[model samples]
Structure formats: C-alpha cells, structure tokens
Target: MSQTPIRRLAAREPEFLSTLDALLAFEAEADGRIDAAVTEILQAVRTTGDAAVVEYTRRFDGLDVQSMVALELPRSELLLALDSLRPEQREALTIAADRVRVYHERQKGESWEFTEADGTRLGQKVTPLDRVGLYVPGGRASYPSSVLMNAIPAKVAGVGELIMVVPTPRGEKNPLVLAAAAITGVDRVFTIGGAQAVAALAYGTQTIPQVDKIVGPGNAYVAEAKRRVFGTVGIDMVAGPSEVLIISDGSGHADWVAMDLFAQAEHDELAQSILLCTDAGFIDAVHDAIDRLLPTMPRRDTIARSLANRGALIHVDSLEQACALANRIAPEHLELALEDAEDWIAHIRHAGAIFVGHWAVEALGDYCAGPNHVLPTMRSARFSSPLGTYDFQKRTSIVHISQAGAQHLGKVASILAHGEGLQAHARSAEMRLKV
Candidate 1:
C-alpha cells in the first residue's frame, strides 16, 4: 500500500476537477447496478410474496431458507438466546441503549394547542408510526450498535411497534444480534436479508407485515430495494458508499488519522477516505503511517483498493480552502483535526456529521455517541439530515375556529380563493361564515 502526496498550486485546475468527475462517475455506476438489482428483487417480492423472499434468500444469501414463514423468530426464543450472552456484553449493550435513549428522549416533541385573541385555536399533534422495520446487516459483521442506534430512536418516539430484519447467511442467526434486539426491546426479529428482506418489508408477505417506514443500513442490493419500495412505503434514504473526509493541520497525529481513514475504507471497496490538509509534510507523514498500518490490518485488501481507487489527499493553501473542498464533496463524515476546530465549524455547510477536535473520532459517533449513525451520503448532506426520533414520528396541524372567528377570517379566505379562480373553495368559506 503506497501513498501519493502531491503539492499543487491553488485554483480549480483541470486535473483537480477531473478527480472530482472520476469520483462522481464511480458513484453513478455503482448506483446504476443497485437500481437494476433492486427493481428485480422488488418485482419478485411483490408478485410471489413469501416464495420470492425464500428464493432470493437462497440465491443471494446462499441460505436455503425453508419458507418466508420461518423468517420471524419467536419472541420467547429470542429473549432466551439474548439471556445466554456474556454479562459484560449485555452490560455494554444496556449502557449504550440507555445513552441513545436519553439523547433521543430529549428530542421528543409534544402536542400543544394555542388559542388566539379572536377565539381561533391552532396547534400541532405528534404521533408515532404504527410500525417500523429495521434492517441490520448480518453475516460475519454483526452490528449491535446498529440495533441500538435504529431501535432506540423509534422506541423513544413511542412507535407502536418495531420489527427488525437481519440476514442469516449460514442459516443461523447471530446470538449478538438477537441479544441486541432483546436489549433494545425490538418487537419482532426476522432471519432474512438482502433485497428480498427489503421487498418483504415494503410489500407485506404472508409472514412479515408491511411497515409504515423502513430504517437501517444494508449493502447495494438492500439500498436499491429501499429505492424501489419508497413510494409504496416510506424509506429513510437511499444510502451510498461510506465516506469520511478529514481536515487536518500539522498538529494532528498521523497514526490516528490513518486509522480513522482506514475505518471507513474497510467498509467497502467503493468507500472513500480523503484528507484535506494545509501542511504537505503532515500529508507525507500520514501516508507513511497508512503504509505501516495497512499490512497489520485484517481488511488490508479492502482498505487498499478503496484508498488507491477513490481516496485522495488534497493539498490546499489554507484551512478555509480545505473546508470549501469538503463542502463541495459533502462527505458522509467530516473530521476537523485542526488546532481550533470550533472556530472553523461555521464554514462547514455540507456534511452528514461533523466531528470536531482530535479526540472526537468518527468511531465514537458510530457506536456509543448520541447522534445517529445512519446518515445521507453522495452529497445528500446538502438537503437531508441524520435519522432521528423525528423520522419515526409524524405531525399534523390542528385548527379550530369559533363562529365569530370564522366570520372574521372567512372573508379574507374567500377573497384569496376567488382570486385564485377556486369558486368551490370561496363558497365553502362563505358557507362556513354563514353557519
């Protein structure tokens, strides 16, 4: 794993612009593949129901699931299995869940009504989703943190029910996942995954009931499936490859920066880990650190491909320029490793989540930290926000008017409706006034 550190002049040079184009091209091609796969999975699940899910699980996940009916794990068995976990692991899960719950509890909204001087009352009513589906990636990587992150928010929002789905590639569910589900009080657990699980969640099968919304992360196929089922049911976002952008000065530690970059890069070959720095010497030191650390890491092959293909070390004239480049990328994770990171935060307009200071690593946010780990990618930070209690809840505006208040406000509404050529609307308001 070799590193390339280049010192180039300021300005949006053609070569630098080409680098951006290359990254965009990579993302587009990846998205296209996901779209195709998701369309097929959605169609199959929509038509065949349980049979389709079972078939896809066998084909894609390499597990011969007997039937979709077998997808739902019995709640009793799930709880027993969780109880079998080590005390330390159970304690850690409980701590993480408590922290996540506490943070999200602070985010809860109330339904309140306010009365106006004219006897008109207006307010907003908050309601939790009837049911929500959470997808946790299975196989070799079992994410207990993901369970706490997704479930705690929905639970805090007072969701009526929560159903969790996870792929059991080896025809056996991970004890850790079940334990996490139990710890977080997940309502139901399913032993299925891939695009088929997404389809089942979107369009209910004989076994898995349709949910009001689907949340959590998955691979390309899962992401595509979410994209396909979006209209039929609500989805959080069409997540893309993981990415992290670090803005560091000469003061940042090279080893920590290298390890942080590798943390994201190891997620997938398409994942990007970039560094924007004002000091060229620090860039070289980090490059050396990456080379030293890559050989010892278990996922070196994945990390290497991600770095060689998509990763970059951008040299900028000043910290302001580095921030400008970061905003343009709109990376999923942004780290400000400068001396005074707090002062530079105002300049950051785009980023799924911003980590300030050297001690605030992105890994903390991924696990025990309060904020959600499920964030928008592919420059989606420009418009979207991280998943939170708000995602699993809905709000409806309330309005009530007394006879006198209606009489006073109706004339203005009638005039506006008539001006817009909506005669029915004008008549309705006029009739209400008369009443």
Candidate 2:
C-alpha cells in the first residue's frame, strides 16, 4: 500500500504557526438547506406535536408507524436488552458504568453558605436540572460508550429525569444502547433522532416530554438544530471533529506513539492527529511505524485521509517547546507520552483531557477511565471543558439582608447603581438604609 506522506513542520520554521493554523482551522458553516429543513421540523413539532414527529420518522428513518407510542421503547424493553447481553458484555458495561458514576459523584455540587457577624447570609444553592435530553447516535454509528459518558453524569448530578433520543433507522435498535440506558437510569427512551428529536425535547410533545438541557453528539443536522435552539433550551455544545495531540520525548516506544495517533485518526477523515517529538530520529521511526501498521487497521482509508489532510509529525527543540505548541493547538485530547509527563502538566494551559505517560491511552479515558468523553473540539478546549456532572446542574445565588447589613451595604449599592444611571435601583437601596 502506498502510504500518504503526513505533513512535517519544524519549530524553527518561520511559517510554522501559519501552517499549523491552516491545518487546525475547521469552521462549521451552516448549510442553508439543513437550516431551513431544521426550522421547518422544529416549527412542525412545536405546532403539530406528535404527528410531525411520526411523519419525520417515517420520512427519514423509513420507520412507518401509526402512533408515536410505537416509537417509545418501554422500560421492560430496556431491561430485556440488558438481560440479553452476553455475560462479558454486561460485566464490562457494568464496570464502566460504576467507574463513570463514581467519578461524576465527586463533581456533584452542594449548597453552601456562610453567615456574617451582622446576620447577613449569602451563598449559592446548587440544583440539578429537572429534566435533560440525551441524543445518542444510532444506525451504523451505535455508541454505547457515549450513553455512559452523557447519562451517568446527569444521574450522578441528581437530575430529576434523563430522557434519551436515538434514531433507529429501518426500525432496528441496538441492544447495547438500550442496555446502557437501563444501566444509567434513563427515565425514557425514544426511537427518534435528528432535528425533530431535538425539537421534541425543546418543545414538549404529547409523547416526548420537554427537557431542561440536551447533551450528546449528533450529525450535522442535529448539531445545527441544537445551535438554533440554544436560548430556547440549553445544549452541551456543537462540537467539531475529534482531535489528539501527543507531546512525546524520544524515550517512549515508537510503535506505541504511532498507534496512539492512529487511534484518534481512525475516528474520521477530518479528525486531526499530531505528534511533537524533540528527536528528529524518533519522528522518522514513528513514520516507519505508521507505514508498517497502517495495513492492519480496519479503518485504514479513514486513517489515511485524516493523516494526509490534518496529521503532522513535528520536530521540536525541547519538550518545553512541544508544550508551548500544544497550548496553541488547544486540542480536545492531549497525550503527554514522555518519561516526565507530570513535570510538563503544569505548563499545559489548555486541553479537554490529558493522558499522562505512555501507558495512559486516551481511549481508556473515552470509556472506563472514569472521565466524561464528550469533550470540546476545534480549539474550544482553550475555554471550555469536558461534559460532566456540572453540566447537568445549575446554581442559584441566595441573598438575605439583615437591618444592620443592609444599612451598611445599601450605601455602597446606591453609589454603584446611581453611577450606572439607574435611579430606581439607587432609590430602592436608599429606602432600605437608615440614613
């Protein structure tokens, strides 16, 4: 097999930043047709309710059903799916669920307050969303892992209800996905997806209950739909393609590093995978490893296209330089595949998740490694974070003013309110003051 030559850049090159920027750039352009279609679907679901959902399901998924009840999978069906799984499958799923639940439990926020000497109590009350919608991809793209990553956090956060929507193309349902819903305590499972499902979740249908927030990955149509309904309902994020950036020293095995890059590249043709090494000789060895191992992968075509388009093998002067470039990339998944991986962690200012040392593969974190896999991509990690218990929860500020406290605080508030040209606010504060 003739291998595609991955792009190589040097840290010393004058155009290095420009070259990297071009590769990292992935802007989500709204397709006019998709947007129009989504708008129609959203409006239809809002106005017509279940009838529109049934029609879209028939039109898109080839599922001819008379009633929306046909689309709703019962809790017994979820239990049946769980029972049907092989012992090994059930065990693995259970273990992963346990780990994810345990990890997210620690992130559950508690209501806290501190009373002042003047009897003024100020604090925050942490509360979970009443209901949340989870979109899990179905058909040929079945991801049980995604179910665990999204649902477990919500359950841990004490969300009142966790409703899931998965498209069952041709009326075929993946058992593993159903089992995951059962394991994660999803309140309802609807075999509807795309823009319609999002709409149903946003605007309550007779059958599908409205959700406080929607979280999970979906196709371009689903993503655009989520974007349009942002203020109407909260969405996790309209994520871009997956990314993995590895900063490796020459000490690690070349084969391991090459496989790590391949694991990420195999996700999709646009998924970016880059490696930064201080040793040029090690980069050559990784190149050879990629060529030798490329034939063995099932998704070699995808890996090849991704590498040819976005992948890079960079030569850096030192590990410090590699860390600097990593922060600039702000990749979704970062691997410090080096001897002293811990030493450089403090230097990294951005990344969705950091996989330390050679043995700590990013794939583990995606599944049973006890962290959420729904991470920010396309440099959004510079400011955002991986989906967690916090996403499913919210906080409300609490304020109780005592006579003594308000008298002292009202004067300060009046000054600020008056400076902002709000006479009403200033007068309101002044009325509470003794003076």
Candidate 3:
C-alpha cells in the first residue's frame, strides 16, 4: 500500500501565514467548458421545455423514456421503496428523518409586527416558498442523508411543494434514497439529474412544475447549471469539496483522532483533513496511528491521495494560536477534540459547524446528529451559513401607516426624493402629505 505523508507546519515558522494561505485556497468558480455546457442546457430547457429534458435524460442517464410522466416516481412508489428497505435501514432512515424534521421545525419563522404610538405598524412577514427542488446525486454518489437534510427542512418551513430530482443512471435507483424522500414528505420525485434537472427546475417544463428555489448537492455540471439559473430561481449555494479541521489538546486517544481524519479524507482525493495541536509528541503518535490504520481502510487509496495532497499536521505554539488559525481557515467542519473544548468555543469567530469534545466525531454529525450536515465549504463559512428551514423561507418587510403617521413620514420621503432630483418620487410622497 502507498503511504500518505501528511504535510507538517509550525506556527513559529517565518513563512507560516503564506503556506497556510496556499493550503486554504480552493477555487470555486467553474471552468469554461462546464459553464458553456450548462448555458446550453439551460437555453435548451428554456426553449423546448419537456422535449429538451427528455433528450438530455436519454443522452446523459442512458434512459430512453419517451415522456416526462415515465420519468416521475409516484408517491406510492416512494412508499413502496420505504417498505422494501431492510429492517435496520428503515429504522435508521426513520430516526434520521425524524431528528432532522424536529430540528428544522424549531427554525420556522413567524410574521411579527410592532405597533407604534402614531398608529403605525412595522414588522417583517416570514413566508415559506411556494415550491422547492432538491437535486440528489445519483449513481456512485447516492446519499440518503442528503434527502433527509434537504427535504425535511423544506417541509418544516411549510413549503407548499417539495420536488426531488435524482438521476437513475442506466435505469438504476437506490431504494434507500426513495425511502428517505417518502419519510420526509417529498411531494414529487423525478428520475432525472445533471444540468438538465437543474434547468428543468429553474425554468419549468410542460410536466415538471417550476420551483421557487433549488437546494441539495450535485456534480460540477449540476453546480454550473445552478449558478446560471440563480437569478431566475433561488439556489442554496454552490458547494465545494468536503473539509474538516481538528484541534486536539492531546487528551484523547490518538486512534480516535486518526479515525476522524481518515473519515474526512475518505470523502474524496481533494477533501482536506488537517490536525492542529500544541504537543509535538502527540502529533507523532497520531502520525503513527494513521500509518498503522491507513491499510485497514477500504477507501485507503482515496484517503491516501487526499492526505498526501490537501491534508496537514500543524504544530501551534499554543491552543490560542490554533484558534486563530482555525478562524482564518473558516473550515466547513471544525472539531475541537480537547478536554475543555467548550471553553474555547467563544473564541471561534467563523466555522460552518463545531463538534466539541473527543466523542463528538464529525461522522456522527454527517448522519443523525440532528443538525443539518449541508454546510458551507471552501472557506465560504466566512460569510455564508448552513442549510436550514430558513433557506426554504423568505421574509418581506411590512409597513402600515395611519393618516397621522403618513403626514410626518411623507415629509421625510419628499425631502430625500427631491434632493436626489426625482420629481415623480417627490410628488408621490408630497401627495400623501397635508399642510
């Protein structure tokens, strides 16, 4: 087996910041080929609608279905998939779905307003989207957890329609994914994927209803399609590769930490798994543990490539320095595997999600930890956020002014509009004002 050598860094080194910056940078923009292909697909769907969708499905997924109705999976089919799952599989899906649903239910926003003394009311009205589309990766990347994370939130947010699109490459489907959709109340499921699915959702077709927003993860083509169709429809985000940054105090077992790193690396060859610690001796111990354990993993080749390329083991002067570096990276998943993990929680200014304590493995959060695992990646945590019920809902500002309130407010508007040199705007406000 090939050995995975983790890059070593020291906070005291003169070029530490420059090296760290290079490692943290991840290019998120799609290439021209993907962008052009996505553009063509979007235009095709926009022009031809259902015919373009069918042709794309046939071309990409190797499915020769003639009509869109043949591509859709009925609600009964979703239920049947749920029932067909093994006992353990069904149990796990049920538990995960329930937890995700419960967690998002608390995120539901309400319409709120406050009345003022001048008979004016000011507030924000929160409303669920009319329809949302979920893009689940099919084939080798089938993820039942994604179905739960994306659909359950939309349902909890009171979205009227939850449409799902998963490609059945060569007419193959994963029953667990369908079961998850059934458990989470997905209103519709289509056996379609890639850029065409995104285009269909954004532009709508003769059969597939146009959605207000499109959420969930997909491949490069699907991501590019989302990027192109964003203005026409809302998208969750253009997610990048998986990542995990672990800060250990050397209080826990090295094997546990090694496994956590492996778990992150196994996602793909580009996935990052970095470890930061104050103790040099503990870093060596964890290195040995990784060497001893790498051969045992089924995805060792991928993990090895990931660690060799993107992974690192940093020696910080103190835990304080580790926290500072962590904030700079703004990783997607930050695991503080220390005895006093909660003590330094407030110090972390940016991270998509924090897994505190030795036992709080990032893998647990990926599945049934109750928090949505769909998070900002590629340092996007600096400004973005995790997927939640709020992503499926939108807010509108509400203002109701009485005659007395308008009399005073109109004066302010009139002055501002006239100063900006707009006669129509100034007159509109002046009409509401009385002497």
Candidate 4:
C-alpha cells in the first residue's frame, strides 16, 4: 500500500482545524452503537441467565457452548500449567505482580472511629467485598498483564474470594493467562467471555456464582454488558476505545512518538492517537515516521483506519494550548514528549494515565509499570479515577449516638425535618428527645 503523504502546515492552519473537528464528530457517532448494544446485553443477562449467555457466546464467539459448566477450570490443572511456564516469563510475571502489589498495598485504607464534640462516635469502616469477578478477554489476543492488573489489586485489598472468567474460543484456555491467574492467586477460573461472561458474572448460573463487583477490560459487547449489569452488581467503569495524546515540541525523536501513537491505535479501529505539537517540522517528521512504519505493522488496516478517522496531527499554537486541548479530551493515555514535562504536569487537570518524558512510553505503563493499566477512558478522567484497590473495597460510615448525644442532635434534626415538611421524621426526632 502506498503511504499517505505527510501533511505539513502552520500551527493555525484552517485545514488541520477542520480535520480535527471531523475526527471528533466520527468518534461521537461511534458511541451510539455502544449504548444500544449494552442495553440489549444487560436485558438478556438479566432475564435469560445461563441460556442467554450460552446462546450469545455461540453467536458472537462462533463457539458451540453446550453448557455453562464448561466455564469452570480445574484448580489443580491451572496451577500445574502455571508451574510449567518458561522460567524467564514466570520471573517477569512475578516481578510485575510484586511491584503491582506493593503499590496497591500503599493505597489500602484503614478503619477509624473518633468521638465528636457531643460524645457521639463517628467513623468510617473500610472492608473488602466478599467476592469479586474479573473478566479477561481471550481470542487471538490474551492479556496476562490485565490478569495481573485486575487480580493483584483485589487480592491486596483483602477480598475474600476472587473469581475470573476468560472467554476461551471453543473452550481452549491459554496457558499464559492461566499462569498469570495462578501466580496472582485468583480463587477460581471460568472459561467464558464476551457479553455472556459478563452476564454470568452479574447473574450467576447454576455453576457460576454471582459476585459483588465485576472488573477488567473487554470488547464493545462486554463493555455494554457491564453497563447493563451495573445495578445488579458494581462495575469498574464503562470503558471506551483506547486513546493517547502526545504533546511534543520537536525535541523528542520522531520515531518514539510515532510508535507510541501506533501502540494505542493498534488496539482497535476506534482507538484515537493524536499528536499536539507547536513545531511544524516535528509534526511532519512524526507523520513521515508513521507512514513508513504503518505498512510493516501486522495490524496495518486497523491502525490506518484509526489514524485516518479518529487520529490526527493537531497543530497547537503553544504548549499551553496543547495542555488545554488535552484537558478537554481527557484522553485515556497522555504522553508528554516535551523537554521539561514535570513543569507541565500541574497544568494537566484530566487524563487516565500520564507518561512524562521521552523515556517513559505508554507501553511501559501497560505492562511492567506498577500503575494499573485499567484506566478511565474517553472523558471519564474528568471524574473517575483509575482502577485501584478501592474499586474492590467498600466504605461504610459509622455513627453511634449516646443518649446524651441523641438528645443534643434530636433538636436540630427535628427543626430541619419540620422545615422539609416531613412530619414523621420530625416526630421521630421528637420522640428521641422525649426519651
């Protein structure tokens, strides 16, 4: 395929601005399908249970799933297979898992109670959920990193039980995924995936038990299924397509920035890869590198569509303008390719994960990096935090009012309740005052 010529223009070029708007519009339109699909998957999972899950797996995965019982993997075999992994691979996984565990252990919270002015004890109790279900996507691509990312945090949070569901095509499990699960100390493994796996997790089958929260990454259908099953069981977040925004001032090597963009774009056609640069020369150079490298990649078609549609070389007037644009997009991954990145970090108000400096690539954060790769995607960075130990745990506010404390608080409560015209609430407080 002939490489598309790299377009070079001034920072304020009208052509680049129009192209940016067109790409943004396309991404906005793509979200429509996600909403509709999630609704269908959720309703199906809610009412049909195992039957719907089985049928959907067969339809979507092209696997003739006879029963949900096949979802369970024998614990012994999983461990044995893990023990057989190449020593180097096992060592790397161990190292990564340890780093992840250490970082998350620091994020763990403690329960504390304190006596208030009126001798009323007020506190917060931190406790892990009884059970959590993790969904691992399987097909041609299996992410052992994802297994480590999701399972280790839950384990560190002190969750009692950790069950995982990975959709293996035709019930054939990947040893690496199993090894990661085994090494991470996952309680159980289920060979199921797609919307069906999510359904099984949200509403338990005869074999798969329901869980308190479902966490991990998956395809569009899986994301939608999570959105639907939300109220039935907690979900980490409704993730969108992968994205990365790099702010470079032409100081970094063009090849590095190009590869970083490709890493995210290779995820899917909907993935967004953007470069915000003040230097027109750097923009052209990076574009040149991308064109030259594109054909060599295995997922060239996916990368091409992603870049042509959703990705762009955004020419910002200055670094400040680039940072402002980034805050608006709230990209899943933000790469600061500038000379002095730390100086700009304080100005960055939104981003799921930030990779500062040329040496720190997004790929590092995806694998061996201790930070969780399961991040808030699209615009969710504006509010939600990256998946952490807290996602697997819940907090309960504790309040204990003594007789004297109640008497003091009751008068204020009654007054407020009466102002709101809630007579029962007012009387309830009045009754407490009388006692």
Could you say which candidate leads in TM-score? 2
Candidate 4 Cα misplacement greater than 4 A, ranges:
5-22, 25-69
Candidate 2 structure lDDT: 0.93
Ranking of candidates on lDDT, top first? 2, 3, 1, 4
Kindly report which residue pairs in candidate 4 clash with one another: 167-192
Residue 77 local lDDT, model 2: 99
lDDT, candidate 4, residue 7? 32
- Tens-digit lDDT string for candidate 1 (1-435): 345332223334658866664664444455666777788888888898999888888886787668766667888877887788899877877777888888889888889999998889999999999999999999887888889989999999999989999998867578878888988889988888988888898899888889989999887677777877888889988888889999998788999999999999999888889888888888878888988889999999999888877887777778888888888888899999989999999999999999999999999999877888888888889999988999988999999988888998889999999999999999989998767
Sort the candidates on TM-score, descending order. 2, 3, 1, 4
Model 4: ten consecutive residues of lowest lDDT: 1-10
**TM-score of every model versus the real structure:** 0.92, 0.98, 0.97, 0.91
Can you give the lDDT of residue 72 in candidate 1? 76
Off by over 4 Å in 1: 1-18, 21-26, 30-40, 58-69
Each model's C-alpha lDDT? Answer: 0.85, 0.93, 0.92, 0.84
Best by lDDT: 2
Candidate 1, clashing residue pairs?
none
